[model samples]
Target: MIWLALILLAPLGAGLAIFASRRAPGALALAGAVVGLVGALGLFAGATGGATVSASLPFLPGFPILLIANPLTATLALLVAGVAAAVLTYALGYMAHDPERVRFFGTMAMFVAAMELLVLAGDWITLLAAWEMIGFASYLLIGFWHRRAGVAGAAMRAFLYTRSADLGLYLAVFVLIGAAGTSEISATLVTTGTPALIAGLLLLVAAMGKSAQVPMQDWLMRAMAGPTPVSALLHSATLVAAGAILMIRAAPMLPPGALLAVGIVGGITTLIAGMMALAERDLKRLLAASTASQYGLMLVALGAGAPVAALLHLIAHAAIKSSLFLGAGIFQHDRDSTALEDLAGAGRARRGIFAGFAVSALALAGLPPMAAWFSKDAILAAALASPAAPWLMPLALLGSLLSGAYMGRALRALWSGTDSQAREPVPFMAAGMGALVAAAVVLGAGFGPLEAMLGAVADPKSWIVPAMGLAVGLGGLALGWSLAPARLLGPLLTPARNGFAIAGGMDALVARPALALAGTCERLEAWLFAAVLSLGRAGLATGEAVRRTDREAIDAAIFALVERIFLMGGRVRRLQSGLIHRELALAVFGIALVIGVLLAAPLYR
Candidate 1:
């Protein structure tokens, strides 16, 4: 419990310290990341074999901020912590010379902390809060270069797009609370109710948005405007992966229809994004599309009731993608260009980088001796085990083929170029790549332990299943290479370039209508206000006329009353005498006059 709290708060605390002591923000961030890393490892070690560690906060009496480490949480916590550490180390080198290094490091730390909290959260409310925090931190990191309009715009789009989906999660939480009488994830999942199913669907919508699947995907492509390190963290480890993690975590509560829906969407996104990666001319954008494609595969795994497979794929992808992004960054920094055409002869100049890029790319393409090969094979096998497995297999195979084709093309473009375009590699950058490549090789070659670790999570007869999947994936790659030179592939290339028009069609169909409706509402509100103002003016004129009439009547009545009062005063003054005796006589006369006035005024009516 203490370790969990430390893990959750360390990065946040470091961010605060960095803010207060801006001179050493990078150092503070590094320290916080180290602490988080230690805590995560401790949690993982303590929670092996499905053990759980939990603690409740006193401040939140009825709904304490809880952190629990089960096999699932431990696995994710380790991944988040490990990647955060690597990224921070890279950031130390990347931001060492920047003027706003403190701000950069601080935001990055906060982002990492939020992801940790997300993985540790035991309840829906806590998870949602962490989810928003991650999104918020991502917005800041993406728009770090605030001076650039493109960066700012991309940041806003990301925020707005994700927030739109977050609303669904908010509603889902409310529904869960109403139905289960608790916000705890465990209780919500165990309690059977119509609202529970509804809440699950709503939460899935939020996951889809955060994951950048289908309609919400354009924001990610735009997000490339941020610093390359930010992209590396986002695409590889943190922001995008959170959605898949959420879905996997909550899989037990998801309705069958919801799962199937998720699978269909995932399959479609994978194919589309893979194709788009093939058509992209920019190196980073190609990687961006590839990230989306890989995430889609994870989603399919989760939807096919294979959380372990999804998670393994996620971890594998993170290692390879991070290295790819970092490599791309180095290439861009050295070459001063991100365009594929301009990168000719880069391989001859930087053989190490080219080799690193190839290894990572093949792993991403699910080639042999890479982690992607094992994890991706598991997903395909799981899909084959499902009712829609037959149809899904072909789609999965096609997506894999597209991924290999594009990644191969990218590799050729990088290495086939002349030696003149490349420069000497940065040591730290090369070290990062080498570490990731080593990890990929280890996981790819020695997947036996990983499979054993999965234990119950692994499907029955998994050995034969996964091996068959690998064969299919490799065959697709071979076929793609053979067909690469043919003009007949043009249509497929166009479709790949457009990512099946999913994001583009979403913008035109859904986003535009919502915007148009908002615009119409604004115009109608203005017209209504103008009409109300004209009516108010007319009402004011009528009120003034009535006021003038009332004022005249009041004036005449006051004047008449004053005149009567003056006459009465003249009669009363005569009764007052100068002397006491005269006054007494006047008093008697006044009493007699009052009696006479009363007798005269007293008519029976």
Candidate 2:
């Protein structure tokens, strides 16, 4: 458990050192990787000696983050640590001239450390937390060159797809936990029936999005826009591998229905992605498509009831594919492009690197003595022996054949071009690629023992299996070498080149809907703005009307009444007499008028 903590923290600390300090980031990154690598090896040693270690720290009231050392987690930890160390080492050479080593290596370290936590997670809560961390780290690493055009978009697309699928993971974890009353991954394996089925299928959805399976696969090829080390890391053992890892971990609890669903999805994705690879013209994009296809094969293995087979392939592919990508990075450095046309004869120029690349390619094609050949045969054996052999076997074979075809095409193209383009070898880069190529060459023989460690046995007596795999692999290579892709792919040629768009790809699913929503929002915003302006105008008019009414009505009436009062006062002043004679005459007139009125009143009565 202490080792696990160190393994997870080493890269994390290195990442902080890279970002937070002004010193040389390469050394810091390398140190972190070395520490993590040593810790993983120690964990592996402990596991082999029949020791298990687990640690739990409080997270929720009852649910906690669980980290454990077991055969599966330890092996994966070693692989992730080793690959991350190698990629970071290679990046030391690759990014020597680039100015952003701090940012690049920092994110790389963070990404690697996150993967360690993911692999060593003993409970769903830890897994879910680590799952999100990986997505964030990948986003940062993939968009490390944010100044580059289209890079931000590529990063966003990758993030959106995976983040959306992450919903399934959230749902699945709670589902299993609800059913089993525990968040511990090992304990949740006891969850069966409908609950398991629902969780398993939900988990598959998450896997598909992360692994670049089918419709979600479009983002992966575009992810090639990132730096090559990013490509190598993302494809090899970190982000893309997470989905398949989840599937393998949860394989025990999946119901047959969910398994069949996973298998069928895998089979379909393998064929289609292979077609895309065969049609790809960019070296990195070709590798990206192949990554999707390879994971598809792993899914098929899981579908065929062989998680061990899938695990073996996963390990083998981590080495082989990273080597291939590293070699491509060297080519990209040489030609300043990954396009097939630009890379023509790149192999001829960099013979040593090309040799390593070719070895890994052959290994990917499942040739004998190579890592994938051993793993691929195990997957084939699993598929062929499964009850669903009719679908599984053929899909696996088609994927295998296509793998050779595209790889052979790449090799021939590289070897045929001029050697005018030469690149100076970077020792660190060479060392990194060399390590992986060696793994690609020798890891095949280790799978049987890996299975033994896990107590799973594989079929060994199927002689026909190896013979068929070799023939198909060699045959695909021959055809690809001799033929043009235009002829080989035929109708698939155009569609695959256009990214196999379904109903106009993003134009239909994303762009059009997004545009419509934007337009609606714009119109709504405009209307609201207009309505606000009209209200302001109305208020001004109302205030003016009130002012005018006060002046014209109330003020005018008061002033007119004041004028009448003044006129009445003047008339009364004129009627007033100031002489004594005027007062006597008025009194006599009043007496006469009173006598006349009294007589008239008596007659009326």
Candidate 3:
């Protein structure tokens, strides 16, 4: 538990330190990452050693924010830490020449810390808090170089898209916690029937946005406007990974109805995104598309009731994808552009970097002995064995086929250029890429132990499963290397590349409608303001009438009475000025008048 806190705090504290002191920001960031990496390993070791680590801090009344070290949480935490360390290490070299390294490193650390909080969260309360944290942190990181035109807009697009989808997460958590009577995530798995199904579908909606599945996939490509390390971390195990991780963690609670829905969504996303990868022009955007496609495959695995397989692929893909992005970053640095035409022959310019890049690319293509090869096979086998095999299997194979094709296309484009200018190697950048590439190459065989640790043993559908996957991958590679992606995809290329839009996706469907809704709301607010102003004017008019009534009618009547009183007083004063004899005479006259009146009254009666 302490280790988990360290894992969460190390990056966060380091980020704050960088922002506060702005001194040796790189060294501070590196130290924090290393400490965080060590702390994550410690939690992993402690979990496997049966340490029973758990902590509950007061968060909500009767709903504590829980953080615990179980096989699942610990393993996920390790994946996050590993990827963060690698990405940050590379960023040190990548941003070495920048003046705002302090700000950059600070935001980067904050981003990592947010993910750690997410991965280690034990209850819905903690998860949701961490979830928002990661979203906010990603926004800052994505727009870190905000001076660049369109870069800040890209960040805002991502934030808005995900923020809108995050409503689903809140709703799902509300359902689960209400039904289960607890915020504990594992406890909520006991919630069955309609509520569980409802929660699962809602969770899938959130995952789709975060993972960049289908309709939500557009933002991931646009996100390339951010710094390269941000891209690497975002795609690997932080922002993009959050969606798949959520689904994986919630897998046990999903019902058949929801599961089938998940399968369909995943299948559609993989096909759409894989084709987009094949058609992408920008290297980073291409990799971004590939990330979505790969995660689609993970969703396919989870939907097929194989979260373990999904997780394996996720871990392998983290190392593989981040390494690939780092290589692209180096290529971009050398060529000053990530456009395929500009990046042509970039591999030859930095042979060592390309070597690592090729290894990861081959791994990403599902080549033998690479981490993704094993993970991909597991997914294929799981799909073949599942009830939805008929629907999922074809999609899985198609996704795999396209994965290889796009990867091969990238390789061929990079290696085929005629220019052969060479430059001295960047040892710092190379070291980071090398570590991840090595992991990508060897992490496959390591999955057996990981599976055992989690007790999620693999059950391939005979030896033929892996063989079939390998054949499909190789065939895609051949097709990609020999033919243009447009020719290979034929008619489907344009739509898929354009993100499967109906006349243009987000612009036509989502953005315009959202803006229209906002406009309507604005008009409504304006009318409301005018109505309020009209009411105020009417009240003022009424008050003015009341004031006039008091001043003209009431004041006139009072003044007239006052004038009469003054005249009467003047008469009395004149009487008082007379002698006492006059006063006596007046009193006698008054008494005589009273007696006369009494006598007249009697006569009248």
Candidate 4:
């Protein structure tokens, strides 16, 4: 519990310190990342003993904010911290000369802290809060250079797309909490039947958006407008990973209907995103598409009822993709652009960096002795053994092939051209990327202990899975290295380059409808405003008419009677002027008048 607290607090505190003091931001961020990494290590060690550690803080009534450290959460926490430390180290060189290092490092720390919270959250309440925090933080980080052309728009697109899909998560949580009568995530896993199916599909929607699956994927490519470190972190273990993490966690609660849906969605996304990757000209966008494809494979594993396989793949991908992106960042720095044409020989200029880049690229291609090889094998194996093997196995294999193709193409492009003339020392950046590349190289062998710690068994070792994996991976590499994307994609090239939009993609499906609804609401509000104004005017007119009636009719009659009485009083005063004789005559007149009134009253009755 204390370790978990350290993991969340260290980065958070560092971020605050960076902003408050505005001094040595890099050192502060690095310190926080290292401390958080240590805390994750400790937490993993504690969890390996099979005792789950958890702490609860009062949040919602009857549902506390829970933070738990188990094998799964601990492993993820370790990945997050590890990747964060590496990325921040790289950013030390990457953003060293920037004027707003304080803001950059502070936001980076905040992003790390939010991810830590997300990994540790044990209930819907806590998870939802963390989920929202990451989205907000990513928005700021993605649009970090808001003044840059299209940067702010890219961030906004990412935000709006994910937020729209986030509605599914909100609804899913409602269903789960209602069905389970608790906010506890583990408790909600027991929910079955319609509720579970509904929640599973809804969760998949949120996952798709965050993970950059299929139609919602264009935003990720646009997100390359941000900094390289932002791209690396966003694509690898933080914002993008959040979606897949959600699916993997919720795998147990999904029913067959939902599982099939997940598998189908993953399959489609894998194929589409892979094609997009192949067709992409920009290095970062290509990698962004690759991230989606890899996550789609994870989804395939989950859909096959093999979450451990997915988890392993996810762990492997975090290191693999981050290293690839950092390498691309190096090339970008070399050429001052991420365009493939611009970066054609950027890697060649720095052989050491090229070596690191090639290693990760091969790893991403699922070559043997690389971390992704084992995980990719696990995914293929799980797909092969699945009930939907006929449908899933092909998708998984093709996705694997596409991964190799794009990576091979990138490597060939980087290596084939003449070396760039300019050179710059990037000790910090090299060190950071080297650490991740090393992890990518050696992480394959650690899955055994990881599996043991989680107490989850992967698919039985099979020769066919590895054989197919190798065949596609090697074949795809050869094809990509030899042929151009035009020859490969052929007639499909246009759509692939356009992100393979289906019925105009999410813009038509979600954005247009939302905008139209907003427009309709605006029009409706205008009408309501006009109607209310008219009603108010009518009320004012009615009030005026009533005031007129009171003043002109009722008050006028009363004033007329008062005027006649004043005239009668003046005549009576003139009559009283005579004295005694006049007084007797007045008394007789009053008596006669009273007698006359009494007689008239009797007659009228």
Candidate 5:
């Protein structure tokens, strides 16, 4: 419980502290990240193999702010902590020369905290809240270079697009609460069918937005406007992966048709984005597209009812892609360019960075003996077991081929020339890349342990599947290498380059109109408020008139009666004189007068 709280709060606390301080925010951020890293490892050790520890807060009634360390959460939490630690370590060197190190470090800390909470959340409300917080953090990080219009625009675009999908998640929560009377994941999963199906579908839409699926994917490409570490964090282990995790968590409740739909979308995104990566001239853009394509592949595994396979691919992709991005960043920092053409002889100059890049790229292409190769094959095998196996297998293979083709293109650009003047990479950055590369190797070598972990949840038929996947991955890579660049299919390249234009079009058409409609509603609300105020003023005037009329009538009558009573009392007092006989006569006369007045006033009249 203490470790979990530290993991969630360390970043947030550090962020606040850094912002409050006037100097060395980066140092403060790094220190906080170190603490978080330790806490994460502690939590992992304390709750290995799905052990859970929970505590309730006294303040939040009924909610408790629970944190569970199930296998899934544990795995994701480790990933978040690991990446954040690596990135923060890298930032120690990367931001040393930057002017806005304070803002950068502070925002990074906040982002880490949000991501940790997202993985730790046990209920849908907590998950959604953390999800939005991460989105907020991304918005700040993406636009870190606020001086650049493109960076700011990209950040806004990402925020708007994801928020639109978040609405679907919100609706899903409502549906679940209405149908199951609880937002707890366990409860919702237990109440499957009908409304649950609808909830699943809505959740898929939210996943699509976050994962950078066809219609909501363009923001990722534009997101390259941010700094490289931001890119690595967003593309590799954090933002895009969150959507896949959400779907995986809800797998038990998802309908077959909905799952199939998820598979179909994933398959299409993989194919399209892979093609785009092949045509991309910018190295970072290529990587961005590749991230989308890879995420789509993971989604395919999830949709095919193979959560373990999806998780395997996710872990492999995270490690390899982080290294690749860091390598790309090193190149860009040296050359001040992300264009692939500008990096003609980068490989010979930066041998270590290029070597790291190549290893990761091969892993991404699912080459043999690499972590991705085994994991990807497992997904294909899972798909084969599904009813849509025939179609899914072909699509997965095609995506693999495209991934190989683009990766080959990148490799050729990096290694083909022999320029000696290319710059060397920073030590800390290389260390970060090296760490991820080592992780990839370890994951690949220890496939047995990973397989065992996954097998506990599902079957482990490893031999044939791994062999076939390796063969296909290697075959694709060889085919891509042997073929001449000019002979590559042109029309397919165009579609890939454009990423089906789905993400861009959706942004311009759907998201823009929705934002416009929101603006219109704001105007309408202002008009309504004015109208209500005018009506209120008119009602107040009418109320004042009614009050005045009542006051005039009631007060005038009371004053008139008081004057008459005073005159009558004076006439009665005049009868009560000085002498005793006179006083007796006056009293008798007063009594007679009162009797006469009472008789004459009513009965006589």
Candidate 6:
């Protein structure tokens, strides 16, 4: 419990401190990462020793904020913390010259803190909050250079797309919580039948959005507008991983229909994204596409009902992909661009960095002795053994082939360019990338023990799976190295380069429609405003008429009558003047007139 608290607090505290002091930004971020890493290590150690630590603090009445250090979550915590530390270390050199280093490091630390909370969350409420935090933090980080061209748009696009999909998660959580009568994630997993199926599909929707699958994947390539370290952290173990992590955690609760949907989505994304990678002219965008493809393969494993296989691949990918990005970042620094054409011979100039890059690229291609090879094998095994083997196996194999092909193409491009003059030393950057690359190379050896630690059953070992993986991998690499992408992709090249936008992809499907709807709403609102204003004007006019009538007609008549009475009163007062003889004569005349009127009245009657 203390370790969990530290894991969440350390990075958060450091981030706040960086913002407050705005001094020694790199040092503060690194210290926070180190502390979080230590906490994760401690948590992992405890989990391995058969102890599961859980902390529940008051939140909602029934749904307390729960954090747990079970074997799986603990391992993920370690991964997140480790990756964060390495990326922050790399950024030390990457952003050394940037003026906003304080903002960058502070946001980075906060993002790490949010990711830690996400991985450790044991209940739906906590998970949802952490999920939102990371999304917002990623938005801040991705648009870190908001002044740059297209950076803000990319950040906004990423945010809007993911947020739209997050509705699925919200609905799924609602369904799960309602069905289970609790917000505890494990408790909700016990829910079965229609609720489970609905929740599963909804979860898949959310996963697709976050993990950059298919149509939702367009934003990811654009997201490369951010800093390289942002890419490294996001693509490797944090933001992009959130979707796959969600799926992996929820695998047990999915129905057959939902699982099939997941598999198909993954299969499509892997092939499509892999092609996008091959067609990419920019190195970072290629890597971004590759990240999507690899996560698709993880989805493939989950759909095959082998979440352990997905988990293993995820772990391996975190190291391999981050290492690849770090290497790319160094090259970008050297060339001042991420364009493959600009990066020609960048590897030759920095042979050491290039070596690390090559190793990780090959590892991603699933060659033996590398971490990804082992995990890829597990995924391939799962695919082969799945009930939908006919559908899934081919997709998995081709995805692997595409992985090798794109990586090979990237390597060839990097290696074939003219060597530039040696540049300045980047000791911090090199150290950070070196650690990840080493892990990428050697992390496979521990998979067996890791499986045992998680109590995950190892996939049945088979010669066919490895043999197939190697053949496709090698074949794809050879093809990419030998043939140009225009020749390889042929008719598909244009579509692939355009991200296979059938009918303008998301813009047509989501954005344009949304914009049109907004326009319609705006028009409707205008009409309503006009109508309301007209009604108000009519009311004012009616009130003015009533006032005019009261003043001219009714008031005029009353005033005229009052004036006549006043004149009569003045005449009557004059008659009461102190002339006695005149008064007596007037009285006698009045009496005679009254007598004559009475006599005439009686005769008429």
Q: Which candidate achieves the best TM-score against the true structure?
A: 6
User: Model 4, range 1-605, lDDT digits (tens) per residue?
Assistant: 77987899999999999999999999999999999999999998888898799999997689999998888999999999999999999999999999989999999999999999998889999999999999999999999999998899788788889999999999999999999999999999999999999999999999999999876988899889889999999999999999999998898899999988898788888889999999989999999999999999999999888888899999999999999999999998888888888788777799999999989988888999888999989988888888999999999999999998998889888888888676879999999999999999999999988888888875468788788888898988988889899999999999999998878888787767777888899999999999999999999999999999999999999999999999999988898797898889989999999999988997876
Local error of candidate 4 at 33, Å? 0.9
How do the residues 429-523 of candidate 3 rate in per-residue lDDT, one tens digit apiece?
88888889998988888789888888786674677888988998898888888889879889998887777877667655555666688889999
Give per-residue CA lDDT, model 5, range 356-447, as digits (tens): 99998898888877888877887888887878887677777778777887787888888878777757448888888888887776686655
Across 157-206, the per-residue lDDT of candidate 6 in tens digits comes to 89888888999999999999999999999999987899999999999999
Q: Ten consecutive residues with minimal summed lDDT in candidate 3?
A: 506-515
Sort by lDDT, best first. Answer: 6, 4, 2, 3, 5, 1
Off by over 4 Å in 2: 420-422, 510-605
**How much lDDT does each candidate structure score?**
0.78, 0.90, 0.89, 0.92, 0.81, 0.93
The 10-residue segment of model 4 with minimum total lDDT is 453-462
- Once fitted onto the true fold, the runs of candidate 6 whose alpha carbons sit more than 4 angstroms away are 515-605
Per-model TM values vs. the true structure:
0.81, 0.86, 0.86, 0.86, 0.83, 0.87
Better of 1 and 3 by TM-score: 3
Candidate 1 stretches greater than 4 Å from native: 59-61, 420-425, 444-457, 460-468, 475-489, 502-504, 509-605
How many clashing residue pairs, candidate 4?
0
How far off is residue 408 in model 2, in Å?
Answer: 0.1
Residue pairs that clash (backbone atoms under 3 angstroms), model 1: 275-496, 276-496, 345-417, 345-418
Regions of model 4 farther than 4 Å from truth: 420-422, 512-605
- Name the lDDT of candidate 2: 0.90
